[model samples]
Target: MSGQAARNVLWIMCDQLRWDYLSCYGHPRLRTPNIDRLAAEGVRFDNAFVQGPVCGPSRMSYYTGRYVTSHGAVWNFVPMSVGEMTLGDYLRPLGVRVAVAGKTHIEADRTGMQRLGIDPASAAGVLAAEGGFEPYDRDDGIWPPGFSDESHRYTQYLRKQGYGGANPWHDHANSALGASGEILSGWNMRYAGLPARVDEADAETPYMTRRAIEFIEQSGEQPWVLHLSYIKPHWPYVAPAPYHAMYSIDDVLAAKRVPRELENAHPVLQGFRQAEVSRNFSCDHVRETVVPTYMGLIKQVDDQLGVLFDYLRRSGRDQDTMVIFCSDHGDYLGDHYLGEKELFHDCVTKVPLIIRLPGAGARRGAVESRLVEAIDLVPTILDAMGADIPDHILEGRSLLPLLRGAQPAGWRPAVFSENNYAFRDFVREPLGRPADGCHTIMVRDHEWKYVHFEGLRPQLFNLRADPEEFDDLGADPAHAPIRERYQTMLFDWLRNRKIHPTVSHAAMTEWTRKEESAGIHIGRW
Candidate 1:
């Protein structure tokens, strides 16, 4: 480790936040000064993308530093395989205390734990149950009618704050008092403009930020990594007072769509277009009503970050703690005529990634336009901590070289992301595809983007010509060569995925061509 290397890491992650919405990323209306400050004092990546478009799969990739297929968590509510190693698994053994403050969207592998006879109360089992992080205060933030049980921490906290109801999360936190004195559910787009009943200080974002601050204060002098994950700027998009009224339809960006996208759309895309959220977002009124609140939620998140960053500075932890701010995935916000994130578009796939490395060895106020993925963060954190990266397990390269202002040789050319739409009603009813066959992969380089579906027609976009990706040329014969080349690249990527995580690359190298010397040779050599 270098003398000036950061001693701790504060990995702050927001859910469903777009890359372009931040002021640092050129948003004209919504100014995120705190996040912009981080970018000014650090490195802001222009082309960072997540491995999956949805919450569960995208967050799984971020936590484990592996692609969605590699981690075996293909969709929401799907538990990652028990054998997968996460950032906590890698860092805890190195004497770094790893903890999480908010949402991870990780479903526990209970069946695997039971099969292996792992006690749920044991330390090893606890770590495995929570996707390797020690949960200081974990809340996924999606509370439906019957889902919010007594054990839900956030609901309990809300109730303690004098908000009483069977489901306080739904009634108070994600709801608003309408003009007629009726409770307006945040789930309804019509009520998005209403301010939530909860106070701004007690909102989900502020509560999670407070929890993160508590974790940091409790950690003391120990070297640690805190995954301060926020659940807001996601669905149930109602912001508390002040923030809810901060912006209106005037500040909402125009929905990026055209008539050509609806014509002869891919079969899978057709299913998505028929979805309720997509149809709702396709309406001009719905976009005007809902997007303002979405913007407000993002602004609130930025303000809370300001609070968190100020605390770090006041506590003097800013000197040796690395601060990384990013989102799990981007929200569609009616982009390309789609709502919520499931398809591969720049609005859904690209995320804002800003890293403020500690001390003099780190680069400051730099912008890197290289194609980087969510999987790259685990190795980056390890590299920053001076820990050896296990190449056999982690499939991402460290960005430490880039942070130090040096270009690493053999950097990736094209970034990859995948999606599984089997869980959606659209995939089941409209597409009529089996669960296993609903997979899709996207590969993109500097000038071109290609989407390959399992049983559907491919999609090709010349990003240089149509940066908004309004036009598709997958069927055009002139672009056939480009599509074929990108398909080949995707195939190569899949074929070379590191499947054997149990053994090290160094061990395999030592055993190669020396198998006969170490053990019995195959075919009786």
Candidate 2:
């Protein structure tokens, strides 16, 4: 507490990793001893929601320390507004070294990155995008120039390792990557999760952790902020060796499968359950293979984490580094008939959040039931490092109060998440229909959830009576009052919010098709 406020912040983020998957949160099947240990070692927020269910927008929120709506990181593929302030901006002035690993959907252009103060020049790894690494190391094997898959390499790697499944929707074409022994340089051509299937010596995580350790080692004396984002337990359901065989479907149980009336409640959630229903997963190959494979992948990540932790401890930085474990977003791995992430269910929106503060007499092993959002990470880190809060950033609050065991007044007991079905131009598969024209926005209190699907009918659930959100109160006359209350709140939300206009829906669809179109990048070029 006496030294300068600069502390080494290691942000460990997982892709499509859910909150409930960790054993600390009442899941008996998911073996997350590392997360469980982290929960025990620090504070775990029971109700932590993400800014958005998808990656890009959520990552943007993480960078700016603001929610999607406020930060204007509206959807996937949209460049984060360069003019806006960022966590890097705050930290750089405070003498902190900011570095990113796995993913950064941050400002797409050079101007944006520089403006936000993201030191891409100092980045240890920038997997997909070019220009992140300066002096270049070809031996790294983490990336090949013009290599375009922006996410989930480990899962794709595992699928090629004998974890075969069909793309019945014909939506997946990367299955051939394994057969040909030819790696597809682009995003859709190669399964994103496949990279994790490599051996420990060659795998991405070990390499990444090694890089983290190396960065820390090289810093003879510098306050570093390392964002270690791991892509695992994601899609393609492909896991490697013992991990690909770790647990069985018997070992992995299903989430609460409620009735289907309230199911149609959100168009943002349409095609969700069916999308999860793969004729492949949960079958013999799946039960004996897929589930265990995912567990194996998770454990693989955990092992690397343990390695990174060991490095920190051995270097005497254990108490000096404030570690945080979280995820960009959660996945719907067969939950509600969804294969990947599109639905706004708790399964995909609620993420594991553990914050470990480094200081004498700082509270440890405290589990706070307060609701928190992923967007809060930026400000929290900044506050922890004693940085100034730029007045323009307004979506999230500093959690210094909660960490200090003081629940300050005026704290909203709810968290919000909004995702436009039409705006995610960069991602394929979770197709969006204009007629459906669904816009989903959620406001959840401790015991209730208010879900508004703009063009479709709304959904209201009493989490106290139906934790599964099975019973819809929106249509019931008896609950009409509650609906009105939520509706008013939704309006109030709009009143205080600024909705950034994006490229039209047609523009989005056109871009998506072109980007995924057999090497297509533009229309009528």
| Best model per TM-score | 1
Write model 2 residue lDDT over 1-525, tens digit each, in one string: 223333778888887777877777877877677667777777888888887888877877777766777776677677655555566656665666676666554435556666656665444223212222112111112232334332334335434544433321012222113556754322231233343324444445565567667777876687878777765555445544445455655776764445474354444454443332433332344334445556666777887787777777788887777789988787655554455565566877888888877666556789888888887887777777777554344467777667767758887757888777664332223544463365578888877788887655677889899876666676678888888888888778767643422334456558766777768655676
TM-score of 1: 0.97
lDDT of 2 at 254: 62
For residues 1-525, what per-residue lDDT tens digits would candidate 1 score against the true structure?
A: 444367999999999999999999999999999999999899999999999999999999998889988999999989998889999988787788999888999999999999999998999899999999998888887566646677668888998999987788888899998778878888888889888999988899999999989988999988899999998898898889999888888998898899998887777877887789988998888988888888899999999999999999999999989999999888777888888988999999999999999888778999999999999999999988888889988988888888889977888999999998878866666767788888999998889999999878799999999999999998889988898899899989999888999999888887857787878578873
In order of listing, the candidates' clash counts read: 0, 23
List candidate 1 stretches off by more than 4 Å.
1-4, 512-525
lDDT to native, each model = 0.89, 0.62
- Candidate 2 residues lying further than 4 Å off, grouped into runs, are 1-6, 107-197, 259-268, 273-288, 423-437, 497-525
**How does residue 90 of candidate 1 score in lDDT?**
84
**TM-score, candidate number 2:** 0.77
